[model samples]
Target: MAIEDNPSREALEFEGQTTVIHDYAAKLVPGILQTEAYAREVLGSGARPKSDEERDRLLSTRLARAGILGDFHSPVMWSLLDEAVLRRPIGGPAVMCHQLRHIAALGEQRRVRLHVLPFEVGAHSLLDGIVSLMWFEDLPPIAYVEGLRTGRAPFCS
Candidate 1:
């Protein structure tokens, strides 16, 4: 018998099939752009933390998703982040610095077009949650909305 049930795997497949990835993160950084250390810190902490083994599996999948960014036909990633996400500093200053540097490096390489939505911008449409929009050349776009602990991928026809 075969049992196939994994939301993360489905999410990864959705991400992998896209030709362009445009995301707006209101609080935390997008998972695809997260560094290994930052991802580990996030996966290990939280209200209902996972076991080390579980965290490892999740980390591996997250990293694999990041790997797609380096592929020959990688999607063009555009990310807009809230200023709060930068100031909040996850995993301490050192880890935050590393994460920031990693993002900067990606921008420099033109792998991602990064934008910072300053706090002064005040409230906006996407202020309530993270929105990820993936575009495909031949198929309809997929918009994924994620909150603190939940997410929904809605397809518009």
Candidate 2:
């Protein structure tokens, strides 16, 4: 869940038009379904095993293909789950019960909003990790933070 964790103040008031930010939980869908089921079980053999309603319909068709890009809108502020990410159940238990029922059906969209920060909401202030903010149009707002490898862009000056 990252598009700079929701930082598109109307895509920074609209300018040229290009605001891409992604994190998708570090792109870890059980290590990409175990590397696409070991590359379709060695490239072939009709390797199949994606039930749970076809992995929640391929994660709701990749979240509606990122809401069809341009003018894409989501996170009208609220998806903050962290209680060990809803009790850490990744691709098990029916892929975490169909990924928590496909994140409760994409939080019954209306521009989604699904808060769940309870692990007792312990610790504080970004817990020494995860950050993203962007707003482009008139360009003047960007903050990205990620590590344990590298990534840190701080703009807005």
For candidate 2, the per-residue lDDT at 24 reads 20
TM-score computed on alpha carbons, candidate 2 = 0.25
| lDDT for each candidate structure | 0.80, 0.40
lDDT, candidate 2, 4-115, per-residue tens: 4322222322212324332222222211112233222212222454555545433443334335322435223233445675575544566566666655665564333555
**Off by more than 4 A, model 2:** 1-26, 29-91, 98-104, 113-132, 136-140, 147-157
Q: Please, what are the lDDT tens digits per residue for candidate 1 over residues 1-157?
A: 1112223454577788899989999988787888999878877776886878878877787688788888758899999999998888899999999999999999998899999999999988888867889998888998877554455676554
The runs of at least 3 residues in candidate 1 whose Cα sits more than 4 Å from the true structure, single-residue gaps closed, are 1-6
The estimated TM-scores of all candidates read 0.89, 0.25
On lDDT, the candidate that comes out on top is 1
Q: Candidate 2, after superposition: displacement of residue 55 in Å?
A: 28
